[model samples]
Target: MLTRLTPTPPARAPVLPTMGLMLVLPITASGGSLGELKGMSLEELADLQVSIVSKRPERLADSAAAVYVLTEEDIRRSGYTSIPALLRLVPGFSVARMDSAEWAITARGFNGRFANKLLVMIDGRSVYTPLFSGVFWESFDTLLEDIERIEVIRGPGASSWGANAVNGVVNVITKHAGRTEGTLVSGYAGDRERGLAGRQGGAIGETGYLRLYAKHEDRLPQKGLADGSDKDDLSGDRVGFRGDWDLTPADNLSLWGDLFSVDSHDPWIDGSDLMLQWEHARDSGAGDTLRISHDRFEMETATSTDDASIREDLDTFEVEYRHRFAPVRRHDLNLGLGYRWYRSLIEGSEVRAADPAERSFELFSAFVQDEIALVPDRWYLTLGTKLEHNDFTGFEIQPSLRARWNPRPDSTLWAAISRAARTPSRGEYDLVGVSTVVAASPDTQWMPLIARFTGEDRMNSERLIAYELGYRWRPAPVLGIDLALFHNDYDQLRTLEYSDLRLELDPSPRWILSVTPDNLLKGRTYGLDLVVDWRPGASWRLQAWYSLMGMDLNPVSGSTDPEGVALAGRYPRQQAGLRVGVDPRHDLELDLYLRFVDQLPDFDVDAYGELDARLAWRLDPRLTLALVGRNLLSPSHLEYGVETLGSTPHEIAREILLRVEFTY
Candidate 1:
């Protein structure tokens, strides 16, 4: 029911905080005397490995990238239920709650519900939507206890992950079925949210394992600004199954799927998917993998018109194969090929429609990466590139070069340079005459003004050239520090420009301000992230981090655009956090998390501070109890606002929850 409370990372081992892994304090508790506590040992920290950076496992201390891990121990004590909420614990990530269910998450900069530069995966499956190359955080849910670890890379990952992996990459890896071979039930209820989940797992004849789970959640709405009315309520139900089989000592197979229905506003978002993966390993890490999957999602969303809605359906099919082997001594090589197909259908009220009504698209991609040990284990270099062809863009290329050096057994220094791109979304290539915005027409003496735009066929992909540097040091057994710095140059950013103006008499003489999306925006961003972990003794641990960032975006010479103020103010300039984990008596645990987020001038959202506290007690080996209080510093506060996906902005109320857990 609880983790151990002893042993700190030994000397000569610096804890990698990248929970963006910008920061993570791996403290766990279950009651013990002060004399019996200790931080993680140096040997343990050095042995920790992560797989997101290069698609293969490597020691966190030896990797050539700024990466971090959030182990299962961190999740159980955080008192967070959703993946998005748990992300707040990561050092460099910006996780803003737009409303009760909607969220805006990003790393480094550019935060929005539709932020396109970040790529996220669950069990090696991408959750990015082709509609906008962004994730719908509201619908991205899972059983938190099943997670093994979350690996986060805070910089460009295009080299190995392909297009749209410009800002960062997140991989949520779940535990193997064999590790969860038991019955578990967990449930919680609070003023703002409540949910229940249960799982049953068992073993197959000789070498197979299986698990099945079901869960449901309901969330009440936030109070509106004008009238303080209830809005933004959300609810969802989900069921999933997983099976793993070992056919032989060297061959394995896994199949998994999930079905879900989430409702918000007036319409319900529904989806289902299944994945099959088979692998055969010839030698240590030398192997071949084949994967195939199918996914479908359908939903109806409100249109600009007072009573109209846009109904859309999408189906996707993908297949991929990969091979990893040591081609030459001290050199590790990896190669992969992938193909995907998408079928999309859109229907709308008589007022508007998709340009082509129905469409089908294909995508083909391949990537290769190699790692070379310059000197046995003291220095290393890596190079990789990806080539992709898609319906929106004919072809795109991404490449990266990285190097790492162990200046001393106690310290590591690394650097990298990478090129990446974000291709156009379906709306940027196919939508036409859509009702986008409505405003007051001052020219018409305050009459209604409508804005509509058509997709531009000549639009180009947004691109980035990123440079980064990092260092890690373990000065003593009780202290560890990690730092990262980055600068990014962006080109061909998305822009909406004035195209035409029309006056329509049929709709009572209104003005129409027509526009088209373009690539007339370019800019640069730079930032630094720092994290520190310290353990004074076995029962006391503290973790802290701070981030500083700056953005300068300007319109190119040939574009008619809106003022660029909002563009630059979309993200915060500074963020800092502190977490304390304490186990005063064996079987009792206490955690305190405090944070400060700078203001977003673009949205007129002011800077704010908050706190979350969690207390847990172990009654016996099979049952545990916890009380969690969130946003405790204030009764309510607005986290984010303005012009990204939703119409209403509501203040998030303080919350308190009581949770219970049982296992057999």
Candidate 2:
């Protein structure tokens, strides 16, 4: 249900290489790159290969993880451009847009703009920021056309990815240079948003391919908090290049880089990243890979009156090596070693300052994973462990054990138990935050109080132990069902512990409340996800999904953080969605999506349901036009509040857009 569309291949003819080759080499062809399962029967869809589970291509029915794949067909038919908006397709993802440039996204529970438990990657490059151990969703500008697929693992992936993968891992894989050939141009027009994109690709020598692309977009401000307009106008531009070369029959090399500058607010946001990788695969199912990358970004943050207007410049350098091979008769093993260094420059306004404005840190990690084919084609067991060392936390260990059993050829059951961690951010260890004034209540706010968040050098990592079980079954040739259940226990969560109340005469005559960050919060969350796919006829496809989540958080004996008690209600308890796609004629397509979200009583957000419609007509083999509408159910509604800064709840407005795309 996550991917609503797939190419209607004639007579179920799928293009694929050998299993061994597909697992060892990064093939960019159309076979496994962007294809979905809409057109394929339930039986064929069950065997679709996905790699997010153990970093190797494995059949969907055999994987011991909760996974979702949004393919190229889904992106083109949905008429959604932003990555965060498209993530709504997944029932497990709790996505909320706070403004034109800010979003709160998470899996299961603990949803916030600064949600630190989800790890995100772009073509294997990490996008998680170390400043706060979260992602700035607005900074991602990858064009939807360039993406091959969005693979989402709804549970912990720390054994494959590193820290912050406690909740889930989202990897946005892009189309390799070979698949994006020729020239492409696209233009979009709407009342609230407009954008243009162009790309060109060509052959390099006899065995290499290269592509370059540029994109620009701008949006008018959204509806104001109290029935007026908020001053968050957004505009940005991005340029990127990708090149892949087949050095030899057994070796390949790739180099890619991008530069983006955004003028959303006064300070502007800018970033650049470059990476190089080499891979070699042998006939014996052995492969080796070496990768190196560098990234730089600059941004300014002024979220609240008490929060300082800080300008930050940061740089990251990383080097990694990975090898995969068969160690014994029935054991497949993967080994990896990695090192990363982060350096940053932080400058704050006169009201605030970072403890160490200029600082650098290093991280070292190693991991090993083994897959045992216990019953050849019927049962499998995978065990993995990751050991990492950081400056703040001396050492940490993450481990996972997963098992899958195929009771019948058409039914599979899997279970997993994993331990993952979320490391401390620089702000939690060295930054001194000032919360100037906070309202004790909404009515008659008196008493000037200052809340300062003090950082501690000795901070422990937030930890999680998760238990999950899943079942996948195809009752008929046309219908598929997937259900997953999970329970998570969390420890060492951040809590606000006040030292004492005192009078500070210097900055201003006010009562100073020293609130130090502590790990005195504990909680447990449980959830279930259900997805169903049905295709009655070749031209008609229908999908439905539902999600339920519950949270119970408590502060420890010596902690006094009321916000922790209120945090239990930040996310909805129930959500559901339905999607339909129709292609009555060869040249026309129609798609409809309807989604419902439960109310967040604690945050003052009401329940809302919305609809999205898209109609596309193929004028020619190389050109197409479409009309799209978003949030058609209502004029506007509030999805969430930027509660950290106590800003007015943001209202989302409806829009109608026209899109034109052409290829040459």
Candidate 3:
């Protein structure tokens, strides 16, 4: 069993407006600006609404899963410049810096450069790559101010999000165009970061709004372990626009698009991405929504040696439709259908190449969920299932059941059982690479030997059965605590197996060794997560979290792989974080954060603690200044990596950033 902790209200409450207008409107008593909402009471904040679990708006306290919501206030007060850095605030999430532009992030366990089990989406656009089943975190960016909230689910979300959501899900929802009706300019400069950004928005007509934004940034290189040298510098720019319109009282439509490009050194890389999306919604007793999107991404990379190069072009188109309604008084029903088409063109050096070079696939899925109100909200049962078909995996199914019991108005308990799967990726099917070269066996005379790795066509999907339980309690109006535990059983995991070895007498006399991928690994993982939020008063707030995890992996019958088993438990066994926010004056705010991560024994990484601080001053309603210091506990340190991937690991250094913003 695995466990996850989520901050939820102790009792069922009325759903609030998605814009958070109800929570912010009351703050006008102090000031008429958004900043006044910082003093909202804990009770009011707990009543905030969320929709990640069931795809229907509901009070956070009523949610049954281990969910966490990061509001815009949290993002601004944290003073984090990147989305990956902000994720460190979430409990049960492991975030590590692999290099200047790469991150190793995962939930529960199985942390690595390609954390394939997690699913990530930005405003309905899936960012996970089908080629490698991982995300390129550096390729995505957004104006932090334009973000509404980020909903993170620590446990399996396959019942609602489909395959690849075996570990967790991250949904980043941006603010509606109408909410950003203003002109804003922001700039930042630091030891490693320099950027300028601006956005212009206004009413298109009586019932419509539009916003356009652009940004450019340059990042200094990081230092390597051998010597301090500039090796991973990067520069990038992006432009985007969004529009929203209310065609009628019951109908609304939204359109948005973005284009971006980035250049990097070390293994010189040039990449570009273009995306477009359109969505429509109508309220006819129940809600009906439809969305369509298209995205194109291209990347080219070359090693410093110039002997190796790789180019990839990927294009995707997706469509989704969802409906929510009440078939009866006691049951709420939600159903959705989705389809996606993906095409990829890949070219690489002799060391690594794909069989066909060009490939395409399609995926179709449908999901349905029903929520039953047992005993009039005191007890509830939710059941959901997802069925999907893909070119690789003919058919797959994910199912889940959850039960919630509210014994008291200020306390709740929940339990869930779910099934999820991680389907094979393009790399697991057509990839071919050179493993290594070595001398022939003792039996042979003096002959060089070569080992080659190839993908298996009969590869099957990895499966997971997860069990979870959680409790949320508000001991006092000013304090809240959440605890969760989970256990997961995984099977049919991928592993390398020796296929055959033979003597070749072709052009040159040498021995050939062959290896292929197979489903030969099994594992079990369990963990506990705890979170606490305390609001001592109107002027101060504190948040803390702790997580513990353990994993045991074994090879099935006739299979042996000690290295794979060791790699399964490479993440930290214990992790914790603390954050404090204080308002010293009406115009000044201070924040301090502390984080501790246990050592990664498998990677020979020592445990480390870090401290970060931020101070901000509001010159006026339209102008603000802030200074932030990160990794302040040390001058420089390594957070992740033995460089399994070609690039060398670099140490993260202490740095300070100053930023200013103006709005009209």
Candidate 4:
């Protein structure tokens, strides 16, 4: 186990929306009603704190490119029992279950076990692993209620966020202590699932507030648990907490820390892990803010047949400051600086020991952005650039330009061009070793020495240049639609090829694993996203979204299926979802949701459709009854494939779950 903490200082206040006049309407048998008040104003809605593509806080109506926001209300209404489930509603994102303990999630394309292009953060703390430069979604469990909102930026964000933000960025922001200023507890049990969560927050004094939460859950086995399957153990439990405080009127401080652990007894392996993080922020006045954070994660796993155990540890520290200035009434200037430290250590079996050689590095970055209002409320232009220095790549620069035109109060068009990068992961370099195998025929011993190159010692990072355009329209007071299109050109893509090597066994085994990261892949991706929200009547609300994506990798000699490769085109080409709700005046609320994902290639597994539905009835403002169903159309489904020592590959299985929740 590993742990550490750094001192810091913090921050939230809310902007309330004015209430519209309520209408006394007629009711229908379907529990729906007519003549409802309109929705919140764009200003009040955009004030919810968003950092989708840029660090600056701009109204959603004024942003350029594609962005989707999942609010707390959205989470509560969806009735999802987990974070992965909630992500299914995000546009341009691919979320699929690989197994009971694994998930494949990414933006745009290249969705896989090591989806190295996208970046994810929890309350500003990056959760991506330095070992693989990918997120271990299984290890990132948290109380959904603690999350304030999730901002999904569906394009390159490397200009300000640094490397690994190649395709898009997901910023998961949590609620402030002041908002959760009360005691709440929730529990659920159904089918093969059971969970409990509790939270408490309130004003500590006239100027300070704090919030704390803890949660635990036992995951159910896959659909075929009775068959003694080797797919996944799937069973697990986790717990964690978060807190914040307001230090002064001009300066604020906050502290958040959590511990997570999971145990599995199936799939021939058992595993457990823990993670903790702390963050602080300060206001420097003059439209300036500063933030700092420290996070750590540790895990240990063992093979069922072998007593050997693999242990890995990761630690990261980050500091950033943002300054804002007004060049004119409608013009703005912004500058910022950030620093991050990433460290990792791995120990275990010989193969594991040779996997990731322990290492640590530092990153420093600075950025400047200007948002010039071409017109008081109808037009804007923005230009930004980020300069970064890292241990592997001494210096790198990323820049972007964007513009937005709002012809009417409810309609807008936007476009942008940006550059992003994906730095090398731990597995790409440092590891070196050999293995010995005994031949049964002649009792001969064969030892093979395999050396991994420290490519970063003299290598360049992967780069991407992207273009995007989008439109938003609210044709009527009760309806709105948003659409976006994008294109990306890649260079210096990390690629690997096998080297010819000879091996001898009783049967004369000749095949060898050849792998390396080369700047030999070129690819392009394009996509369109549309989301529509309508409130046809006072009691009825409907939401729908559709996505179409295309991805192709440049053909290389001797590679017959380069474009159809697992990571390149494994994401669904089409995805759509719908949500409907009816709230009657009698404190009774009913909501339903549906989702569809197109097929994709995965090793030996065939693509399949995933269906999920939810039903919730609010008993009162503080309590609710909900029935949730995941993959209700089937007991289990195969979404991904895994290769072992033999030629026959196995696929990971899906599961069904039902849960109930209550809050007070």
Q: Global lDDT of each model? A: 0.80, 0.81, 0.78, 0.64
Candidate 1 residue lDDT tens string, 1-664 = 0111122212221332322311121111222222322345544665687778888778887766778777776787789879999899989888888777788899877778788899998887888887778887877877787787888899899888888889899999887676666665666788988887778777776778888888888888887676887657999999998888887877888898999998876456889889999988776658888999998888777544644677769898999898888558989998899999999897764455577778899989999999988997688899999889988878999999999888788788999999999999887777666453655566556667677767787889999999999998889877778899999999999888875668777847677887788999999999999999887766677999998999999898878768443577978899999999898777777989999999988888889999999997766444457889999998888878876344567788899987755555
Off by over 4 Å in 3: 1-34, 37-40, 266-284, 305-307, 435-451, 498-513, 560-562, 643-646
Q: In every candidate, how many clashes are there?
A: 22, 1, 8, 6
TM-score of each: 0.92, 0.92, 0.91, 0.83
lDDT of 2 by residue, 485-511 (tens): 999999999876777778777755667
Better of 2 and 3 by lDDT: 2
Q: lDDT by residue for model 3 over 179-285, one digit each (tens)?
A: 77666666677888877777887777677778898887787877877677856777878888888777666667778788888776533333333444433343335
Tens-place lDDT digits, model 4, residues 237-258: 5544455554544445566666
Candidate 3 TM-score versus the reference: 0.91
Q: Pick the candidate with the highest lDDT.
A: 2
lDDT for residue 458 in candidate 1, whole number 0-100: 86
Estimate the TM-score for candidate 1.
0.92
CA RMSD for every model? 7.2, 7.2, 7.6, 8.3
How are the candidates ranked when ordered by TM-score, highest leading?
2, 1, 3, 4
